[model samples]
Target: MDLKPLLNKLENYHTEKPNRVFTMYLNTDPADPDQQGGEWRLQLKNGLNNFETYLQEDGDSDEKRNYWAVKEKVQHYINENERNLKKSVIIIATADEDIWFAETLQMPVKTEFFWEEQPQLRQLKELQKSFPKTGIILTQKDQVKYIDAELGTVKDTALYELDLDTEDWRQHQGPHRADSNLGSGGAKTSKKDELAERFEANRARWYKSIAPELDQIAKKHHWERIYLVGPSDEVNDLEQHMNKKVEGKINKNLLDHEETKVLNEVV
Candidate 1:
């Protein structure tokens, strides 16, 4: 598809609110219900009037309409306050598999990381060493505490908050629990329950893990807003919990794209 029109729309959208950072999340997973998996694109706009027209003409569905609405709101906000758009930044997060597709399409690729088998602390340390400039750790809610400790000393290390519905956790838990029951049901259940209990017991650890990084981001960038986007149920739940803890410091939004699709959109 020709992305010029979309790009032009985004350009106009951005022009309107030059001060607010503009972040876009695209679902790249082939299995994502919302995404028609393909090459990703970024469209910068100073406003959304033209983009809204294009979306209407493109015949996006009701769900797509919601996406467009959010996009338009951001666009409109930018348009109304063009003077404030200078410090704005655009960030896109997606799956590792779609990174190639995004690169192949020549789309702008920001930071890229995937869920791995090792503990989040190890992963964070490795990532910090590699991308030393990175100040924010985007991860599943369950790993926040681990990530916090891993990069606590690093300057400007903050956790981006993402929300996943509780229902999604319930849906995934059946199979997760089933797998837990396999071979060593009792032992697995006990271990899993123990982990959950630990998460609950030391919830402050999770917040403290990224608190320093968040402060740095705010201080250095004068960043007043944060956008979290991800698939992990633990991450989503933790985001909600942290929002309460951090109070005015964090801004949380739940990305509605399916797990798979999230990669496509962000990557």
Candidate 2:
């Protein structure tokens, strides 16, 4: 599809209202499988009403409650703005290696494949490209220090530990954990349920931690559209979850890196 038009649209969207909020999500943890997909990284930003409300509901200490609140708010937003928000675009970024592998394998592949091909070799290359100033390849144990020095304090970013130990993660994937209800069969009702619970917990934690910042951004920019960029599956799930819960105040558009570049051609 034509990307220049999209980029121009984005530029126009931002220029028309300089105060509009733009937010991006980045997976900074190198150890995480999700973060290793790209070299530099990508982010999505848009405007939405009631973003602050979504942030407030995400603070529940109870993981289930937090998940439900966040989902509900998104659904409410979608329901309220069925027409204008439905067309919002989601942007994603994938590295050259990922695209090559997917085309080569003729199947969807993860970045781990490239890393496994030549762990040390690829690691060195990536590290060099990631921080050209660093002359040597640092060990995994030294990653935190290297990142802190190269990227500055990690605290400023949306980076944190995954709470695998939580019950939410143990039961269902991140998107559906809150809606789970224990059945008589127990044992998670099924393996699918268990995976869903885990995903929900992981995602909930990430969202909760970042919601406050998002709220501030929304308020600052007075956003009316939201773009979500990430792994296709994750972005789809997030959109579904939000639409089911938030109502009609937000619109979601999903797009991959190449598609995004095309969409943002104006920039």
Candidate 3:
């Protein structure tokens, strides 16, 4: 979801109880055949248990009591919200009983528990470095794909494929320019140029159709960082047609079309 706002809010939070922040990095991709999603609970349990050892070693008696007072609260939160987590989940609990949650596309491999005088955000800072609030649009002549990536997770938000005739591209071609007065080969050159323009026009039509949808998705999801990944020419055309809201979020355009490769670059 939208984490930038939550992060901003957490930055200002004040708490009297030992500020205990529970950061759990989980792999929630159930579709992956090799992943065992059922182990997340046990991982979280072990993580908190390890944190208790760290706390006992590092803190005085008063600080230790304050930290453990809210152990059950954090566990309750995990139980209630476990199903909503995506690839990565960050939970923050303070002595003031304020609980905050952020779900991201990026999942980290470890669980970290921290208690300090104030909110601990080191994990979030590191995550933001690798996973910015970004949306990716992957385009092809026959199909268009919209993916929203933030934190550490990647989601396929939308996909569109051309449903018209297989030879519709042929319609963009026309008879070679036949003007004879310019030069012997001017006709061929002019015809090729005209055909190129027609081809671009067709591509533009396809790009325009998805531009608004991308705009809606970005705004609805509060995606402030946008990446356009596809052929250079088509990506350029698509950006030109996007609404100002989406246009302002355009951070980069990549010269690639394969979704897996694009994910490697963005992720």
Candidate of highest lDDT: 3
**Local distance difference test values of all predictions, in order:** 0.32, 0.27, 0.59
Tens digits of per-residue lDDT for model 3, 11-124 = 886555344544455555445443465666676677777768877888667656655766666677667876675555566665446655645343554455555555677777
**How good is model 2 by TM-score?**
0.19
Query: Lowest-lDDT window of 10 residues in candidate 3?
Result: 176-185
Best by TM-score: 3
lDDT of 2 by residue, 129-150 (tens): 3422110101110010001111
Model 3 alpha-carbon drift over 4 Å, by segment: 18-89, 94-97, 102-112, 162-201, 243-261
User: What are the per-model C-alpha RMSD values against the true structure?
Assistant: 19.9, 26.1, 11.1
Runs with alpha carbons beyond 4 Å of true place in candidate 1: 1-141, 145-189, 217-225, 230-267
Candidate 1 lands at a TM-score of 0.24
Q: All candidates' TM-scores? A: 0.24, 0.19, 0.56
Ranking by TM-score: 3, 1, 2
- Indicate the residue-level lDDT of 238 in model 3: 81
Clashes of 1: 42
Q: Quote model 3's TM-score.
A: 0.56
